[model samples]
Target: MSAQAQMRAGQGASAQAEGKAASKANPIVSALHQMAVSVLSEQLREMFEKADDILFDSAEKARASDEQRLYLDTMRIVRVQRNKIVQAFQEALQAALAGIGEDEAENAAGRLDDMSQWSLEDGDVLEERIAVNNMQAKASSLYAHELVELQRRIARLAEMTGAGLSPESMSPQRIIHAFQNSMRDLPVDFPIKLVIYKLFDRVVVGRLSEVFVGANQLLAVHGIEPSLDAPTPARPESRRAPRGLPQDSGVPSWAGKLDRATMGAFGAPATGGAGMSAMGAGAVPGGLAARQAGHLAPVGGAGTYTDSMLAQDVAQILGSYEHGRRPQAPAWLPPENVALVARMFDAYYRDPRLPDNLKPVLARLQLPMLKAAVADPRFFHDPNHAARRTLNDLFEMLLQFGSAEAAPSPQMVGELQGLIDAMVQAFNLDPATLRESARPEGVDERTAEAFLREQEEMQQKKNRARVERVRRIVAHEIRRRIGERPLPSGVLRLMLSGFGPLLCLDYIRSGVNGASWTETMRLVDRVLDSLRPDAGRHAEERAAEEAELVAAISRRLAAIGFSEERLKEVLSGLLQAYLELVEAGAGRTGAPAADTVDEAATAAAPLPPEKELQGLLSILLVPGSWFTLWEPVAQTKHWVRVKGYYPVQNTVMFGHYMEERFLQLRATALATALVDGSAAPIDPSPELQSAIARIGELSFERVVDPVVWTTVEGRPGQ
Candidate 1:
């Protein structure tokens, strides 16, 4: 076998072993396994039902085969579920990590701790239960609106046709058409058009007006007309009987065939429809047509609707038309195209690597996809349609957002909304004309497969290009920082090994988001300090650098308008902290203690500079820290203390803060120059002042959290 195949096989074997060992230990894994088994059992039962006619001669025979089928199905399901659970858990964990910021040391640590404690039997179960409840609540809200609309529309239709429906004509196609006609006033690209179309599926609609009820005196109290309970005519002759004729023996002939006609309308026979007796359409209680119609109708009799129901139905239908439940394929869009795009999103949504929250957002794209297809045939006809490419870009953005812990930023949300809005507007311009325009120009089924393959290859190429660009950017920045100093061979080797690729990917991201120069420099200083040889000369040089940093920072602050006294105070405090940090590192600070020469020797042993540097750099250069370029490591002393600054959570916010400060410093220096008559007077832009005011208005707490400098239990070497 090839090396890749062998590696995969080994991994599979190892994972299986691990899962077996942890099955009893991890309640979460156990629950997932159990859920998988349950799903498989239901699937097996379905398979058996499908094969009943061919595989079993009788009920007894079917029962006899159950054990064998169950055993086989269970074996297969266990394997599938194992793979699924491992992949899904890994993906969820990674996505969770993506949201944490470099300076969010506490949060990252807490997240890991919580993850470690997760048990499907307890913590996750509670969350899942909560999620389920929220989903139900949303569904309920949607249902209420739908129920009202259905009642209103049905009532209007009933009034128009004297409260009766023609069963044979209420085919799925016609019902969909009726709904479409009713919503003619709505915008062509409205999302509810898709929801209404989806509900047209026969399984969901299920005999729209079907009803059932008892034949006895119960009908009297319910005010259900006896003739309304008439069943579907089992014989053609009964159907052909005069409309006024009494089909049921219990009905008086004088009451006329309208009762039999009513029975036919309800799709119920006089003897009752199957298991039901004289239950009229109104008596059917509730059906899928009711429950699933949460967006359209309530659980009510199919025969009649009240004014309240009509009002509700009208309200919901209008509400959906105005504010869609989700994005959908636009009207006049092709089903083939809709299905193709839907399949793509479904694949992404179902992928184990993606977070679950993303599914709803991804699913909304169906409508937009359909709208795109209809608006420009090239979206469906060409392999490299610009619209399709844009969609692919959006998909990547969505994945990135999903991977993070924090909610997507307002800017991203606005961008997505604007994109969708533009598409809908373009689509609405001439929906009628574009209805059939895309199909004839589109690729045929045979070519479609090839087109999709080519597109997939292009997508892969794009991803590779992106990674390479980011990698180059990171390497450039790191090299620039190192300047004339030759990077140690060991450090270079570490960079070239696995570290470079990952770090570059992260650094590029930070750069794109606009990492501040101060943050970048701090990271460089930390890495260099950790790795630098601990010679006596280097220690003396570090002390000089510390004094230099204090002076430089104080100068910068003073230039930005800090009073001399404040600058001196800040400088004095920082210098004292640096001294303590250096002394602690040399084991010359802290409480006085009696120690032998051996103890001193041990403390002063030749520092394994390379090893210590590697350990420190490895800890701080983790991927999560790349975005913010700051992370806290557990240590006894601040080995590389420069300034008491913490990284912000986002590059935009960081850039904003830095820019505002720079502007202030620039104005200060310019004013000083002007007073000396060495420079021209400067006038501040009104916009700049407004921006500064807005920045000032923002709470410091919202932009960044302070990192606490604390002495921990152990240092890296210790």
Candidate 2:
């Protein structure tokens, strides 16, 4: 062969070798790359097909000639360019995957430059840029849960493979960029492009859960941990010095017998004949194995591990807390039980969720709880134990009435103080007194339950009345605004059926003078003005104004709980109405028919069964369910109780036990908060039960490395 031919062959051989090496280096990345390309290609094809149907359906339903023509033209262009779009998207996705580990700074800079270029370009480019951002935000909110799970799995894979990967590597931005880039050369206007983008969002982004699942499964097959365990902070070093039993302590003969029985129960060989010497010399095994052997069984069928012989010991510890003194765990208590209680309370004290004022209140319970745990063998093992139940109820009540940012009301402070004081005073050897003091006003369980139910019903009635008042205010404002200027029938319907409820939400959240109310009122004026023809303005300027009005109105209507599909329909009708008024060269001909305004106000179109059911489900806030309320301004979470659901306004009213005013959230906004992790439902299980489980987990960790607890003796209030 000639030298030139040999050079060409060598170059080809080098490229093939590099490909093999790259594939061998990270099989996981290669698998993921292939998976993404295949899924996106199929999704793109399906998205176009769905877009065709959506456009056809929209065109058929369009009320005005102009609106129908726009849909038909967009559909035709999409159909003709479908193959090229899919191929472009496939190439873009492949390129994005290949660039996963590249420097993110350069990519971000490149994006910034591109955005600058778009701003300097014509109006269409700017419109496309805004559309992309809006689509990304909507998709992210819609698929937040799936995206989070996918991100966790990807991170695990990256950790195992020593590869750099992130959620951004496979974000919807890539899909959107690729699709937008493909359409950059198309002849469609911004409105048509926007319709296509929405369809793409609905079809492609909606099916992202499948793509995420596929990627997760592939990573799982590659030995990556599929389940993500939340990272726990390292246990802090103990501050308290370890205390051992005193050698010269007074000890009765019966105590010696009890010590021997306890050691025997733990499988420790009792030696030196039942005395302090036997207890000190015989090392008690401290773990699950020792517990399984019934180490805490009552000595000689007595009611508690420590008999009346240790009553004075328990009293000394309890009195320390009552008198504002530092308390220590009794030496007579088993080390394992002491360690468990200490660790549990330590965890509680360190928890950021617990309010500061309540910390001292909870601290007072430490000694009493430790005493109860020592007396009851089943304290840690049984979740339904009476003492555990009482503790759980008390902890929950404290959380309900307390706020990290807000001061507790005087009534709240008094009630909680009284309950804690009663429980501390009444708690003796028997745990029954703890249960009695946990009830309201020290009443019996049945009477307490009845009283609480009645209080809750009254709160619900108050919430409903408040919501009705807000609704009336909103309805009156909307009526007055529309009556100020003559509006087309369609505009009147949109105001009543779509915008009215959202105004109510705004008024409820922030009063009539608030920013949300002001912005919504501005949107209402824009909608009214857009329907009138502008004789002097250029066609392009008028079109741009109309586009802005539609986008603003779409966002406002979305706040009233319209689904994406329903929103498209509403916008279509709105656009058609605008076109008819413009074509007739009439501006504010007359007020809408009185019957039309009244009917629109009173009768909204019935929601589809599925939509109605979803709305209902979103408002199903069971009373007493605790939610972490996100205050964006304060950047803090406050515990709030689900007071009641008001179906008339589709709102959930949240109450702070210390605050008389309730915080009402529309169901849509609440659902969005939950999806974005701003609001999270706390575990409804008993707090004490959860703490015990954590203690068991900590114990297991200690068992694996016994030295972890060598210096950490149980210090009750430390």
Candidate 3:
């Protein structure tokens, strides 16, 4: 009937023999078990000391009087329970290594080599080191949690006694008395003494920072057995360090309090009201302390709210961070706004049209949205609020622009800009203020907006116009190849539109040698075959085509270090757009809607030449490439002649030479000149050359011939 009899009965002769063998074979497991037992026993002792007499009537008095028969019986039962727990751990350890190979066991156990001496060159060794550190951290955390619980109990006991057990005012005698009375179950080692001092240190700086004191003295004398000394008076103002303010000295006198200072910071009290719990009834405002000290039931509470309701509110406030979803609301987010924003973010996150690359941008909007909601809840709270609708539109517009390879059309940009300006004006908000609130460091709103515009202009030069130039050259080559046959203009245009941006990107990423018409056409043919009308019906077929296009473009993108998942998605979207155009031209339009054409059923329409040019300009402006000026050399005789040249490094690829293999011009220079349509350069000087680096061949032939020239006499006509 006794615990010892039961423990002995549970472990049969065979089981006891196996446990003994396991403990001896795995000394590491035995040591770990010993450590766990020591910690658990101390924790049990603290729990017994903290629990009110109502919970276990004899706990306090029984433990103190070991001479009593009742106390001896309790010890025997505790010892039996402890042995059972240790034996269970030993059995678990043995089971874990039951099927492990000798080498793996040796590696896991740190038996082959002392882990501290293992070189970190091998990934396996590094991982083992990390695993060891993680285990140590877990052990330390467990120890710290128990210590925190003990400190909380001590504070509660002090409040009950009305003696106010302030760590700051406690003498060596009091510290030793508390340790002997409360922690006698723990092994009296330097490690346990240090941890006790660490607990006092955490209380001094944590939520209880304003209440508990004397960490500096305790830390100074930690790890040494205490000698009885007279208790000091209440703490001095100068001796108490305020929370958040650093000590004047680089290191606080209590700096050596804990090995894990960061962990201790979190252990601070969560509320400023915690100090009231440790104070006397007179110290508490009104009867707040008395209420908190007693069973924490409301004085007039009945059935106002149920436990389930409170739980639901807590869950809603916590957001979905635990479920592995992103855009989680901050812990400080108000409960009312939590569900609304969570639902809104969920919808945006799930939209298939939203690219993966723009998710981060969408997430960043969460904080700004929270701030705005706080500023004006009515604008954000209503599902159909105009401001909310405008914000959604803004996010979509940004996603579209950020996702595209080329810049958006000038008209489109103007429209969005107007919308943005209108939204701010209509809401009576300041653009500068909003920008300052949301913008991260080093990212100026004006600078980013300017960069986007520059992209539009740059794209205009290199994109459509330059692509057209390549198309014309390709067209000429095709015409020559099939002498009298009519040109396959439809197929050629399809190829050019679908693959042009990729080829241009390739040319820019590497040199012109990296991409050629011969190679580009080869990939284009594959795309064309996969995108045939019949193949479009098959999801797998379309996916294959998308994969091929992405693979081709990604190779060059990788070279330029622009290998983003969203880039592939954008290319796939473009392919779909082009295929829809070709399919529409083949008269494959489905039924029309009563009010408007179904978006999927409608044919894709080409943009007007001006619009397309604007779009092209937008695409060309981006992160890389330097805008430069190349002045034409002049020769004067009877007439003045200005010989223009594109000075380019052989290594650089220009947009105009997308189809050209042997030579590549700088897209920035050619694009700038084409946009201006002027022979006059920005004027290259030593300072400018050093800034932009103009070290290349003066390839005059690469530049387009001039339509107008200046005469020696400064006349317009020659």
For model 2, residues 235-301, the per-residue Cα lDDT tens digits are 1112222224332222211121111211222122422211111123323222211332232223253
Q: Per-residue lDDT for 1-718 in model 1, tens only?
A: 7785565446445545554453334322232233333333333333334333322233234355654454344434333433443343332222211211112323322343364555533553344333333332222222221222222333333344352422221122222222222233323332222322332222223222211101111111112222322222222122132544335442222111112211222222432211111122223313212321332222354645422232233223222222212113233443334334433443343222245544434433433454566566676557546556545654554545554445654644654554444433333222233443544343356555554444434332322323433444455445545444544344443333323333442343243244534444464455445434344656778877766655555443332223355445444533444444455556754542221111222232322333232222222222211111122243221111111112221111111110111101122222222233232201121222232233333323222222232223222221
TM, every model: 0.28, 0.31, 0.20
Q: Flag the better candidate by TM-score, 1 or 2.
A: 2
Question: Alpha-carbon error at 301 in model 1, in Å?
Answer: 34
The Cα local distance difference test for each model comes to 0.33, 0.50, 0.34
Query: Which is better, 1 or 3, measured by TM-score?
Result: 1
Candidate 2 or 3, higher TM-score? 2
Once superposed on the true structure, which residue ranges of model 3 sit more than 4 Å away at CA?
Answer: 1-126, 129-336, 339-368, 371-386, 389-486, 489-718
**Per-residue error (Å), model 2, residue 644:** 39
- Where is model 3 poorest over a 10-residue stretch in terms of lDDT? 258-267
Best by TM-score: 2
* lDDT tens digits by residue: candidate 3, 1-718: 5785455345434444554564454332232233333333344344334323312344344445532444334444344444443344333323222221223333543532365655544654454334433332333232222222223333443344353233222122222222222332333433323333333223211222111111211111111111113121222222233345544332223211211111111112321111111111112222222322232222343545322232233243322222222222323334334333433444344332345444434443333343455345454424334445445545544544554555555544544444444344344322234323433222133433343233222221222233333333343333233233222344344434434444543343232355454576566555434433352365565567666675785553333222244345445544554455445435646642222222332223433333332223232322122222233544311111112222233122221101111223343444444344332112121222222222121222233432233343434542
**Which model, 1 or 2, shows the larger lDDT?**
2
Worst lDDT run of 10 residues, candidate 1, spans: 655-664
* Candidate 2 global CA lDDT score: 0.50
Q: Which ten residues in a row have the lowest lDDT in candidate 2?
A: 701-710
* Clashing pairs counted in every model: 32, 0, 18
